[model samples]
Target: MKRRTKIVVLGSALLLTAGAASAATASEAPSPRGAAVSEAPRPHEAAAPETDRPREAAALTGTAKLHRSAGDDITFSFDAHLAAKDKADPMKATGTFAFSHYQNGDGARAEVAVDCLLTGGKVAVVSGIVTESDLPGVEGKRVGVTVHDLGRHDRLGYSWAATGTPAEMDGLPKCVSSAPFEKVAKGTGDFTVVPWQPEF
Candidate 1:
């Protein structure tokens, strides 16, 4: 009877030890569904809000005029009043140019290059060529000018083209010899221009 009692007590103790070991193993194992829940953000944490910003302005608008001196040595005078699209400051420039006149199959051609400085130390360099038709009429008298901007090496620059009819002038150098030419011309038309590209 005494030995049977001791064996029963030992068996009960072993059963309790097995139950504790099984519980520890279950606690250490990870649950498949709950794994992702641990990585989710807490309710109080939030993402930053975005804010609005202003964009940079581009392009300038204004009027310009070009004068051609009639003689064997043809010369050009250029002037313009420019207003920046982004700012209220007004800019003015005056430049002198040397041109070559030639007779093309279609008509007369004039090519010019100019370099000038603005009031505030800004530089303006222009290169252009113009053509006049040989036909008789408004079309024949019409002059087409193509202007290009030689941008500053460090920053972008601007350019424009304008054309007008000849008018009488009071003060100008006399033609070396009597020739058929207009004395003065005012800007009456403008061509759409694209903004100069920035230089890296």
Candidate 2:
């Protein structure tokens, strides 16, 4: 069954790769009780025309954990090292990414809203131009900007930027491929993500 899930997922990814050309929409993946995974933007924010500050999506409200095993040789634990498993922001100037296959993200949604180029965990000042990639196949490709934390640091969060802000930040660089992720999920399973893995 596990292998089959892999096969199914990989097949879907390939199809989605080409299908993404005109995919136009995203699907909603349900989560445990309070948190719900979403492929589309909220009615209000989605309604807004442009991407602005790093606002938490109402669709995004919950706790998360990213970890590695004690016996493992890897460095960070799920809480300290989670992959930005899936990312999409209508805020993105180009394309929308649908996140699937998230593994240990218990009780929280696996996506967030950030300027395609901007990637900051918390922001001190909005002075520099943080760069980031944009959602593809759209009006703007991936410009650069900065992601400012909502000022509430007790709860962890992320912001997007098109350019790089040289401020003091804790968020790891976005790992679009084989690098270690920084979110937590529900399990003892090791999270090994590649550019092609569905998520989870």
Candidate 3:
């Protein structure tokens, strides 16, 4: 016709440039061995942080009967045990502290062993040393006591209650105590003191 219409329009422009160069070489191929090809999506992960814990050590028994200032009449007891807050020896405690004293016929009795124990709530502050004694010169010496349960009016104090003269207090070192004041004319029991923490 007009030269076969220009050779059929140059073979339809070389079959439209070989179908766009075979779709740019199959989009730059690379994905055949078990091909699944299709990925782009990932991002999500982050969380973790919180910690703090440590504290426990407290126990001091009781048996009271204190009333000083003139009538004199002491008789306190406790079976202590405390020391473990990372313990660098908060006086490292153990147990035992039994005392007795009268006034009329003059009396004395002692037995300490524990070593430093301090509390805050029900109040407590026990020192120790006197292994055993009939009270004279306070056996080995190194006492300290102070209670204050106060439910039925419990209270006591003695570093050797009113010893020698001017309100003496012949022993007191480790954790030196004092602050149950005094006053427990005659109690039966229940002074389970508990509260404790770096407190003095």
Instruction: Name the lDDT of candidate 1.
Output: 0.23
Against the unseen true structure, what C-alpha lDDT does each candidate score?
0.23, 0.23, 0.58
Candidate maximizing TM-score:
3
- lDDT per residue, candidate 2, 42-155, as tens digits? 688664444654332211111223232422111111111112323343222222221212223211111122232223333111111222212222122211112122322112
TM-score of 2: 0.17
- State every prediction's TM-score relative to the real structure: 0.18, 0.17, 0.30
Clashing residue pair totals per candidate (backbone < 3 A): 0, 47, 0
Local accuracy of candidate 1 as per-residue lDDT tens digits, 31-116: 57757655554656643443433221122112222233321221233332222332232212112222222222112222222221
Give the CA lDDT, 0 to 100, for residue 141 in model 3. 69
Error of 3 at 132 (Å): 1.9
Model 3 lDDT tens row, 14-101:
1011123342333445656886874533443222223334434665676656555655455666877685563445477787767665
Q: Where is the poorest 10-residue window by lDDT in model 1?
A: 7-16
Candidate 1 segments exceeding 4 Å error: 1-72, 86-122, 127-200
Candidate with more favorable, higher lDDT: 2 or 3: 3
Looking at model 3, residue 12 earns an lDDT score of: 5
**Cα deviation of 39 in candidate 1 (Å)?**
79
Where in model 3 is the C-alpha error above 4 Å? 1-56, 61-72, 77-79, 85-98, 115-130, 135-148, 155-183, 186-192, 195-200
Error of 3 at 7 (Å): 99
| lDDT for 48 (candidate 2) | 47
